[model samples]
Target: MARIAVIGAGMGAMAAAARLAVAGHRVTVYERSATYGGALGAFERDGFVFDTGPGLLHLPAVWRDLFLKTGKEPLERCVGLTEVDPASRHLFADGSAVTLPNASRAGIVSALESALGAGAGERWGDFLGRARDAWDRSRRPLLEEPLWDDWQVLGRDPYPALRQRRMLRTRQAATVTEVGALELADPRLAALFEGCALAYGLDPRRAPASAALLPYMEQTFGSWYVAGGMRELARAVYERCLARKVEFGFGSEVTSIVVRDGRAAGVELAGGAVAEADHVVAGADTALAAGQELWEDGDVRPQGGPDAGQLPGRFAVLLGLSGARPASAVHRSVVHSPDTGAEAAAVFGGRLAERPTVTVLRPDDPRIRPDDAHEAVTLTATVTGHGGAVDWRDKALRERCAEALIDAAGTAVEDLRARALWHEILTPAETGAVPAPSLAGLGGRYLHPANSTRLPGLHLVGGHAHPGGGLAHAGMSGALVAGLIVEGADFRGSQ
Candidate 1:
């Protein structure tokens, strides 16, 4: 049995550890933090709770498959997983609104048509049909398997754009922004189409038409909320790893990757102690940043800085409110910004929009709130990452941003400002980790580096690696890494 050394106790790392252990490998995970679940964290104060990371989970089959593979116990048995109905309620800037039903195409269309007008739903439904085509074309290579060696083929856009005659030449959408403008035809529908990309911190203007896969997946598969918090999902995975006899070294930070004879020999910890292993898998971005040379020249380098797969810093305003959450309120509501173009420029350009799009999450779970009489609300927005043009560290700036979000939430929640007993602002500086999902177009600018590295016995997993980020993608990443190690490079994917 190969002794595998994994870096980081993040979801991806833990997932890999569990699978490797089940495969009879002696896996030891080294974590820098005291806890698992890198971005999947929670905040608790005076009985009020909030998920510091993603509020809703899409593509839950990824985790369900993990549970099915790792243990006899299913995912539902571990967490109170339920589909969030009225998938999302969107509050447009023009005061129009619509609550889309969970995973029901007809329901979503009818609701959109009722709210926005007769043709609104039809246009969106048609767009979704096309988006479905995109999903079918890109699903396997992008999500279900390891990234292709000639990933350039995957770089070629899979989104089949409807060609239109413009003068003497036929035209098709190159970017999602164009797709919205040309096909959706209405500003609201356009916003709905673009919002999907923005939710992943990708600018719609630059995001490839293939990004249609994400929204299509969400509408078809449905969005879900964990009972306790997203952290519970992480807890379930960690427990599964322990169940498989995977060892963990919490508080033991990997200082460097120890290489001997041009192969990854093991990992050196923070205190100069070396743990020898047959293979090393990096499930966190820390390993990439901590050791750059491990990746030889021409390897898929994880880029940083503004606009280079560097996600906009998240500005989350967690509100502890005094009234019971209204039964009529949907679990998630997105209050759209009046101007998406300007908002995109501000957010991606290292500046903050005065009126940014805010996603308000009000979970019905009692565990997150003090009681039924009180409610816990989380308002999140994509702004400039910390140390950019906007200083999230500035208290006054943060307060102003919080106030702006409260103003936005007021559109969705009644008495939002007045109901708040207290408010806590989590800036990009505070919550450093943000979601980054892999997209399949724009010449593969959004695709992550391959899982296999230049050096033998070294593999990559997690958001920064192949298949990209997001909870579901991270799980898929772990499965892919485990497959590569267990079955060799010939492993195609999950059948």
Candidate 2:
């Protein structure tokens, strides 16, 4: 069996390590932090806990498959998986509200109709049909398979075009913004559609019409929450790795991927000790890996897209409330910005939004808090990542944003600020992690780098690699990398 040295203990890296270990390869993981999970992290104090990264997961089948393939225990047994019904409650600028059912198309349509107006349900349902077409057309090429060598083929827009009514008129909705304006035809609905893309750090106006698939995927697959917190899911994956006898080196930072004779030899740790291996898998950011001389000149590069500096970052607030968990509280709520256009411009323009859109998560799960008398609330927004445009370190600035979010929460949590016993803030500065590149336009440019690098035994996996970010996509990245390394470059995809 080949010896494999994997960098970083992120979910994707750990997932790959677990699979490779189960496949009989000797695997060792080197983590810079003392713990695993990377962004799948959590914060706790005074017995109240809050998720530091993504609060909900979509397309759980990815990790479910990971668990099934790597061990006898199913994912459901490893962690308490709960479907978050009424997946999300949206509070629009017009004082309108809607509760969308989990993965139920009909229920979502009915809710939209009841809240928005007559015929609104039909419009959304019809839009979902178009979105489904996009999803079906691009699902395999974009997610299931390793990125093609000639990835340009995947760039072609998969969104089916609407038949033009006027003679000789051939204009088509090419961007998500166009899809919203031409198809949805309501500002509130447009906000709802764009909000989904924004949640993924995508700019709807620039993102291809295929991005409609974002909402489609969520509405179809349903969003789920672990009973305790998302951290438990990571913990379970880490435990799976341990069960497979995969050795872990915590607080061990890798300085570079050692290369010899045009192939991956192993990794060089910060302390100068070298772990020689037949292959190296990088679960960290591609740019950082490259900077460490993991890939030589002309080895490989991303197809196209803006620099990492242009990507948006996440800013968050963790509130420790001094009140009983409200019985009627929904799992998640989104307060759409009053002016989405302005907010989008600020985020994509690398400026902080004066009134940013906010997503509030108040899990009813008891494990996140000390007792029945306290609630742990998490508030997050996608903002400018580079250039220090948003000073998260400024206590006054974080407080101002927190106050605004509390106001936006409205009835979601009655008198949110008044119930706060303590609060914590996490900025991109603190996270200090690279944002995943956006999948913009139909051009192949947005496609992340492939798993197989020019180096013979070096592989890339994680949010920064092919198929891109989010919990499910990162897991998919790991599967793709492991498949490529185990089944050879000719491997089509996971079974």
Strongest candidate by lDDT: 1
TM-score of 2: 0.95
Error of 1 at 312 (Å): 1.3
Lowest lDDT 10-mer window, candidate 2?
Answer: 299-308
lDDT of 2 by residue, 140-162 (tens): 87888887766767678887756
Displacement of the residue 444 alpha carbon in candidate 1, Å: 1.4
lDDT agreement of model 1 with the native: 0.86
Instruction: List where candidate 2 sits over 4 angstroms from the true fold.
Output: 163-169, 287-300, 303-309, 388-391, 433-441
Error of 2 at 455 (Å): 1.4
